[model samples]
Structures are given as C-alpha cells and as structure tokens.
Target: MSQTVYQQHAYRSNQVPPQKPRPEKTLAQRLLSAGQRMLPWSRPTQTVSTRTAQVSPSQWQKMKTIAPNQECFWNEQTLEGLTGNIWARVYLIFSGLGKFVILYFTPIFIVTLLLTSLVTTGRFGLSDWIEALWAYFLYAIFPASIIWGQFEMYNRSYWKPKLLRKLLDAQKKFELNRRTGMVTLYKRGGKVRYSYPFVEFDCILATTPSQQGLVNYSLLLAHRYSGSMHGVPLGVLVTPHETVAEYYRLWNMIQCYMDVTQPLPDILLLEEARPKDPTTAAYDQQTGRNPRYWRDMSDDAYAEAITQIEAKQSKMSETGPEIDIFAKAS
Candidate 1:
C-alpha cells in the first residue's frame, strides 16, 4: 500500500531534530506579549487570544499523529438534536438522578434479591421455606412500591425538574461547519445558544491540579474579548499529561477540521463523515485515501497506534510554538 497521511507525517517526538528557541520579539511583538499578562494574576490561561488556530504543517503533523487520543472524547448521537459537522458530549456532569436510579438503586435491588434468596434458603426448619422466602420477597414489593412512589414524587418536584430534563438534554453539540466556517453552541435543552464564525472565537485551555498534583485539562471556546468564565466547553482530556501541548494538539485538530484549505484530521470517529465535508472529499478523491483506514485496523494495531502517538507526543516540546493569533486575524 502507498504511504498513508499519518505515515508520511509520523516522526518520533524524540527524533524531532533540534529546533532553535524563538528569536527576540520586535518592539510591537513584545508589547503584544506583555499585554496578555496585564490582567489580574488570576486571569485564566490561554484566555487572551484574538483568532482561532491557524495550524502550521508541523502542528498538523503532530495533531494527526495524536488524533486517536481524542477519538474517545466525543459522542455520535447526543440529545438527538444534532446532525452534520457536529461534535457533542455530555455537557452536564450531574445531568440527572438517572445514574443513581440505574447504576446504584437497581443494582442494589437485584443483589439483595440474589443474596436473600441464597441466605434464606439455607434450610432452616420449615419444609416450605423456599416458597415462603419467595412469597415474603414478593410481599415486600407492596411497601417497596410506596417507597418508590415517594422517591419519584420527590425527584420530580422543585429543583429536580431542571435536572431531570438532562436525562435527555444533557448533550451539548457544537455545529462546526467547514463550508460555512461557523461554530455553533447549544444550550442544555439543545437549543442554539451561541453561534459565530470559527475565526471569531479563541481557544482557551485551563487546567487544575488534583490533590495528587496531577493536572487535568479542559478545552473551551469563547468569543474573543468575552470573559474567561463565559467559555463553552469543548470536551476534556481524561488522561493526565505533564504539559499544555496536548491542548495545542487538540486546538490544531479543530483547526484542521474547520479549515477549507486542509483535509479533515484522520481520526476513526470522523471516518464516516469525511466525504460529507467539501475539502475532505476533494482531498480524499485526489489522494485515493482509504476511508476505512482507521475503522479497519485490528485491535492490537489500534493500541500500538495510540502508543506511538503518545510516544511522539511525550518527547516533543512541553509547549508548542507560539503563533500570534492577532496577526493571523489581521
């Protein structure tokens, strides 16, 4: 087979061949850099950019190489409200009482039935003990039904109705249109909350240290000049990393997905949607790119691919090259 997109770009981060430190900034560049720090010390990180990512060739290479890391971060059908050029996930962490109902309460009832049946059947006196145990279990359901009714009434009243909607509305989808070049955000009810051209938003990445001192990262998109707290979520990386480059990789991935000049990032989840995006369709036709390259991989090969992507990521710069997003905007 001919060389694939990733194969052509794949270089171990360890083999990244030395890069020189950025040259001293010109006076104008220095002022721009200093301006980002003028805000309060608590001002959020990656919060003062003016344009969306304009991913360079090397950044694209790194992003495509690491694309597998992001495949697990998104879901296909969310809220049943999205289709076409969509990225969505569970927007509300505690969307409803459903987890308690399905995971905890139901499991407890099943386990209790099994355990009581086993313990109460250990032949103690009465010849009809098996029948009696089952009869008592069935008889308990009347009181259990009352308890369930009270729980349901309580769950549906007051503060819970807002949360209960999340059983179906928890998904928040971003309508990223490469053709139209817009990024749309949805509300908890799956209504359009905000929409803007992709270039009008800035990528914001924030991380907090756990008690274990490991840092976890979150990706957000905010209209430029918007307050830090106003950012909409762009999913998060569950795996911990030592530095912020993973944020850049993710940002680059978004850029590739939106840029009409480039093909879509080669990730398994996007395989089916590849042909639907204009630029991706064109590029695939020109290169005869295998649509099933990712989906057809064996489980072991997929695991190895992830290892390689991470290995490339680990040895690279802790922070990737800086781009003056303002300049790109100008």
Candidate 2:
C-alpha cells in the first residue's frame, strides 16, 4: 500500500499556480494624476481653442466708449466710438447755478442798488448794495465752477483710466489661459512627451493685504518648485499680472494634496532657504535658478497659481489696496 501511494504523489507534481490580482487605484491617486494635465512642464500636447476669449471690433468699441484714454494702446480706435456716462446731475448743479446767478441776479443787483441809492440820505449809499451783490455772485460762481471741475477730473483722472487698465489686464490674462489650455503632466526624455490635465482647481488666495503681496508670494513659490516633485513632473499656469503669486499658488496646491491626501515635505517650498544669493548672480547657486518674476509667466499659470494661494486674510487685515470689484477684487 505504501509503494502505491508514493507512485500516485509523483504523478501529481505538474499542478499550475494561481495568477496574482492586479492592484486597484484609489480615487485620490486618480485625481492627482488627472490634475497634472494642467501643468505645462508635463509634456507637449495640442489644445483646441475654447473660443471663450474674444477681441472683436465690438470689444474695442466698448472699450473706447467706456474710457478711451485708458483703453489698450493697440485698440484705441475702438474706444473712440464709445462714450462715458457723465454724471448729469453734477454738471447741472454747477452750470445751472452759475448761469442763474449771472443772468437773473445781475439785473436785480443793479436795480436794488439804484433804488436804495435814490432813497438813501445817509453816508451808506447804493454802492454797498452793488459791491455786496458782486461779491456774493462771484462767491457762488467760484463754488459751482469748482464742482464742475471735480466732475471732469473724476471722469478723466480716475474712472476711465482705471477701467481701461483692468480690461487690458483681463484680456491679456484670458488670452494666456486660452493659449495654454490645461496642462496636467509633462514627460520628456526620448521619443514620447505628453501633458495631462489634473483637476479644474479653483481657489482664491489672498496673501498679505495687497494684491501685490499676493502676487509676490505666489510667484516666489512657483519659482521655487515648478519642476519635478517627488520624481513626478509638474507645470504651472498663471495670469500675466500674477506670475509671482502663481508660485505661492503651487505651494498651496501642494498644501491641498497634503491636507487632503499626502503632505509634501517642507523642501518643496522652503527648499533649504539657503543664504541669499549674490545680487549679481542671475540664478541661485544652490538651486541653480532665476527668480520667476510674476509678470513673465503665462496668464493661466498666474490665475491658477493665485487661485491656489492660501492667504492669512481676515476682516481686520483687509485695509490695504481696494480690491478691483469689477475684476471681483482678485
């Protein structure tokens, strides 16, 4: 019986092993990978124009109508056709009062002087009435003239120029976003290169109190870490006006990953905050990079970067520059 059992065991030696199961990806990993498509450094990718951006003849016309002098240097012709809404009441108050005094009061003043003079037997003659009338009329005219002047000043100096600047800035920003589209990841080495769009990240970062500060901080962050992160490639998009702030936006993007999924090490932002580089040096010695001035970056990066900035904003700290409400004040 033992010899028979040993022979059976030798014949059963060719059994096949079961195959291992493939690993499944988590939602967080999938999202992070998807978001990388927005990064320019990811890889070369073709983009379809969104057609959301427009610089038509009508836009120029509207720009001109609102504030010609303040309109874009390249699109002055459009502004020439546009007209600003003058505060009619302000004009009325000044010009109307001035005309009324000159036309109606002049005769009354003269008549009162002549009548008073004829009736006066005292040293105080009608000359006093004439002099007083002239003084009162001049005083009234001066104030009215001032009010009119202020109205013109507001329209010319403040309203039109400010509006135009904002429009130009916005147009430039949008044009950039349109050109860049969404870059998620960039892989470049031998033959293959491609970009991926991560997530449609929309965050509002209000750094320090001023837009300038926000711009500075954001840009600095981008400059510090727009390259590879944890061996994974990265790219950034931002507004032209907010390149500086975009850097900070990247820092916050990393922050978002950390808070929600995995926190990046401090080196991602601070990066060994070494001693200040030489003033004459074009790039940092240790980091081997130049400062990424915000204005130099593309608009999509600038906008996205700022959107990711994490501001220490509070009601008490909102007293710096007035937010441009038309542009949603940042």
Candidate 3:
C-alpha cells in the first residue's frame, strides 16, 4: 500500500509556456508597403510651362510674329483692362454729353417759344387763355421731350468702342474653350462649329446712329471674331482694318440671319471697303506714299509665311530637308 502511494505522486510539471500572439497589421499599413515598392518604377510627370525662354533679338522678333493667341491669358487680360477702361471712359463721356445735350435743348426750346410768342404779338397777356395754353404746352413738351431725348441719346451712345471691349472681355472669359483654342459661335441641334484660328470682325462700326440692336450685335461679333479688344472704334466711325479682319469668320456668320422672314437682325458684320475718294487723301511727299492694300495679305497668311521662312532657314542650316524657298511663300 505504501509503495503504490509513492508511485502515484509522479506528474508532468515541465511543459513549455504558451507563446504571445503577434499583432495583425491594418489595411493602411499594407497599402503603404505596396506603394513603397512601386513608387521608384513610376514615370515622372512632364509639365508644360507657359513661360517661354528669354530669346535673342532675332528670336524675339520671330516670336512676335507668332501672334501669341488667347493662350496667354495675360494678353487678353491686358487687352481687357486697357480696352474696358478706355471704353468705360468713352461711354461715360458720351453719356454725360448726351445728358447735357438734353438739358441744353430744353432751355433753348423754351426761349424759342418765348421769342415766337413775343414776335407774334407785342402785347403781354395776363389773361387766362394765354396762361392755360402755356401750361398745356409745358405739360405736353415735358414728358414727350424726355421720352424722345432719352431714346435719341441711348441710340447714339449705345455702340461706343468700350461696348465692343466689354463684349470681348466677356467672350475671352466665357466663350472660348481654352484647351482646344476654339471659339463657339452658335449651337443648333447639339452641334457646334468654331471659327478657324482667330476670327475677323470686318466693318463692325459701319452702322449709323440709329441701328440699335444691330450695332450692339456687330460690336459683340467683333470681339467674338478677334478675342481681343485692340481695334474697336471709340465712336460710330469706322474701325481699323486690323481689328475687322481679326474677326472675319464671325463677320461672315451674319449671313445666317439674312433671310427675309427672319427676326429683325440685331447685328450685321459689314464687308464694304470704304470708297476711295481723292478728296480725303493725305499724301506723303517724301516717298510719294500711299496706303497699302492690306486685304491682299492677311494676318494668318503673313504668320504662316514667316513660320515657313523660319523653318526653311533652320532646315538649311542643319543640313536637313531641302526646302523649295518659293514653295513656302504662299
């Protein structure tokens, strides 16, 4: 019994302790590791900077010929500020003049009436009949003259050069597609076509004093054509050819409204060249000079010719393609 009790006391107390569990990683940690492995293999992004290099005299002259489009937002911005302010000043001056014109005519007309009454009858009437007639004329002339003067002033002052600048500034910011460099003119049936390169304006200010909506429309189309406000006229007088031709495509667009049954045309891009009158000619005796026909060589054509000339010069200097010097002229 004693031997059996001693043998029963044996036990396995040397077993190993349980190991501590490792912490699991989160999704963020896994991603970070994966990113680290792939980053060195990825290609670096190539950014195209707008700041062109400081060019040489010849290169600078050449760059000017490129006609730096509306791509440089600053070009249009400069134009907007300059043109907008100029237009604002012009409009304000004309508006003030218009107001003064109204104020001046009223007194003048009253004086004319007094002179007429005095000339017709030498007697000064303190009678009720004279007083009633005078009151009636005053009442009738006040409202009617105001209405007429307002209409005339508005019609005369509406189409100043600043209006064109305002329109152009708006178009540059709102209408142009900066990526494609295309200007949207009109949209129909979900389809759109733009002017080729820069638009030309033609004779926007050709209108007389009474062409209200038509004049405004022409001014709008002028900016839509050029995307810049450089050549718009200060008054209803003729615009510079440089400004008009810049927006020629948009000028041609006025044809869409030429139909007889169409709505009253608000805008018309005129193409009529000013008649050559010997009476208006101012000559230069030094060179016996006359104004050149700008219509013969367009801005676009001139730009292309310059580009071609440069390309050929570059090619010849580098021993590359043999350019027919004459072929590039056109």
Candidate 4:
C-alpha cells in the first residue's frame, strides 16, 4: 500500500485581518453636539458651599454705639429757585385765596342757599339742605385741598426754618445725635421733583440704673406738604432689648417730650437674633464641604428646624407690645 502524503496547513503566529473604514459624522450631528456644549444647562453641575457669617454681640453693640443721627436740609439756592419762580408765586397766591374761600366762605354760602330755599319754598327740612351742602363741599374741597398742597410747597417760608429750628431744639433737649439725611426723587408730569426733606433722630435712654441698654428711641420727622400743611410728625420708634415694659415706658417718655395729648404713636420692635445649637453652629462654620452633602441632609431635619423657627416667632408675637396709634381717643 502506498503511504498517503497528508497535506498539513501551517498557521502564522502574528497576523491581523483588514478592518472596515468608519463612517463620517453628519453635519447635523456635529452642529447638535456643538450646541449641546454651548448650552448653559447642559454643563455638569458644580458643588458650591456657602456659610453666613454670624454677627457678634460686641459688634452689634458697637454698631449701636456708632450709629449716627440724621438731619436733612435742602440747598438754599435750590429752595429759592423752587419757591421764587414767578408762575409758582402766582399759583401760591391764588391757592391761598382759594383755600380761604373754601374754608371760610363755603359754609356761609351753604347757609345762604339753605335760607333762600326755605324762604322760597316755606320748608325747613334739613335733609335737602344738608345734601346740597355736602355736594357743594365735595366740589369745592377737593380742588381747594390740592391747591393748598401746592401753596404749602411753594410757600416754604413757614415750614423750612420752623422745622429746622424744631429739629435743632429737639436734638439739644434730648441729647440725641443725627444720622445722614435721606433725599427721595420722584417724577411729576415730565419733570423730576425732589421729595420733602426728612430726618431721623436716635438716642439711647436708660430707664433705670440697673436697666441699662434697655431701650433705644428713634424719632422720624418729615416736611410733608401733601398731608399736613406743617411739619408732619412721622412717628416714634421704640426698640426694647429685653421686655415690652421698657418699650412702653420709653414711648411714654417720648410722648411727654413732645407734649402729645393725643394717642401715642406706633411702636416698632427690633427683630431678635435667633440662637443656634453648638452642632449646627459648628456645621455652619465648616468651610469647603460639598454642597451636595449639606443638601442631602434629612428632609425631616429641615422641616423640624422651620417649625421650631415659626414657633419661636409666634411666641415672640405673643410677648411683644401692641400699639394702636389710630385708636379713638378716650
């Protein structure tokens, strides 16, 4: 038997198959990718940490000590220019005359009308007369009031020096300090107009030797021509540190100084700083913590904290002072 020659195939050790070429990206796909990169919200979010700096008790005390009193005054030249315009002077004179007529002559005119009606109709019923008087009064009073307001604005001679003197006297009598004046601007018709000047007076008053730093009083006065034709007494602000009793006492003292016979002005309380626990304070003081870590805190904890804060506020309201300046005088 002939020996069969078996053919054996030899395999190479290092050989690679040819790979197919990759498809090119479409224009739309490239543009979409570029837009995604440019979009603000598409970017990865970064963690941020924020901590509010606590105001120290000493710093608060220093702030109270250094806080200056305010007194506002307009420039003399500006005041002259505003009050001295020929048209403004003419308007002021006419307004004054109109006010006099509305205040003094209107009642007489109404009485005359009532008498004439009675004489003509032989009727003395007050209903018709009163209604007629009311209608006439409304017609005359509205325009007269507006004109009077304009008169007050232009005739600064009565209010300007008087208010300044009052402020000066009050400061000297109360030993109060002045803060920076605040000027407001408004637009009227197509022109800019300056608001009436105003000032704030601040002073620390001690009710008793043992009760030092108990109350802080502030007086706000403004030259308001639109409401009252004279210096408008804004109000007295009483800020008590510990108790509402102190606030009442300080408010009464202010009333006595002003010789106010009417109901006392409203009292505004200062907001108290909330106290934090040691753990929370430490956590807040910590710097460079991942924002996500703080945000991941238990929802229950956040809710509880809010509830506690609200409860504290309610308690404060219950303990705070109640002042109603608008209450009818007894």
TM-score for candidate 1, residues paired by index: 0.48
Ranking by TM-score: 1, 4, 3, 2
lDDT (10s digit) by residue, model 3, range 29-118 = 455333111101011111111111212334433443443221322221111101233444554565556555457755775676677668
Residue 20 lDDT (model 2): 28
**Each model's Cα RMSD:** 13.6, 25.9, 30.5, 32.5
| Tens digits of per-residue lDDT for model 1, 1-330 | 112222322222222223233345567755533312111111112111111222233443455454423222222211012322212123222323444444466567667667765887764434455565566456654445544553444334423355434453226465665555556777655778777655556565666667898766666676653332355555332234524555555565555555445565666555656776555678899999988776666666765766676676566542333443333211
**Each model's TM-score?**
0.48, 0.21, 0.22, 0.22
* Residue 5 displacement (Å), model 3: 95
Q: Which regions in candidate 4 have their CA more than 4 angstroms from the true location?
A: 1-83, 153-330
List runs of model 2 lying over 4 Å from the truth.
Answer: 1-76, 79-88, 119-127, 134-139, 148-330
**lDDT of all predictions:** 0.48, 0.32, 0.31, 0.32
C-alpha RMSD of candidate 3 = 30.5
Q: Order the candidates by lDDT, highest first.
A: 1, 4, 2, 3
> Per-residue lDDT of 1-330 in model 4, one digit per residue for the tens?
001211111101111122222235467645533311110011111110001112333443444344323121211001011112345446657787878877898888878997788787857467877887788768877778777764554344334455433332222111111011122332322133444322121122222323564433322232223322122121222222334333333333332222111111111001110001222223334643332332333545544544564455434322222223223434
Total residue pair clashes for candidate 4: 4
Q: For candidate 3, report its TM-score.
A: 0.22
The candidate maximizing lDDT is 1
Which of 1 and 2 is ahead in TM-score? 1
**Clashing pairs in model 1, backbone N/Cα/C closer than 3 A:** none
lDDT of 2 by residue, 220-286 (tens): 1111123222222122233333433334334333322212121111221121121221211212444
**1 or 2, greater by lDDT:** 1
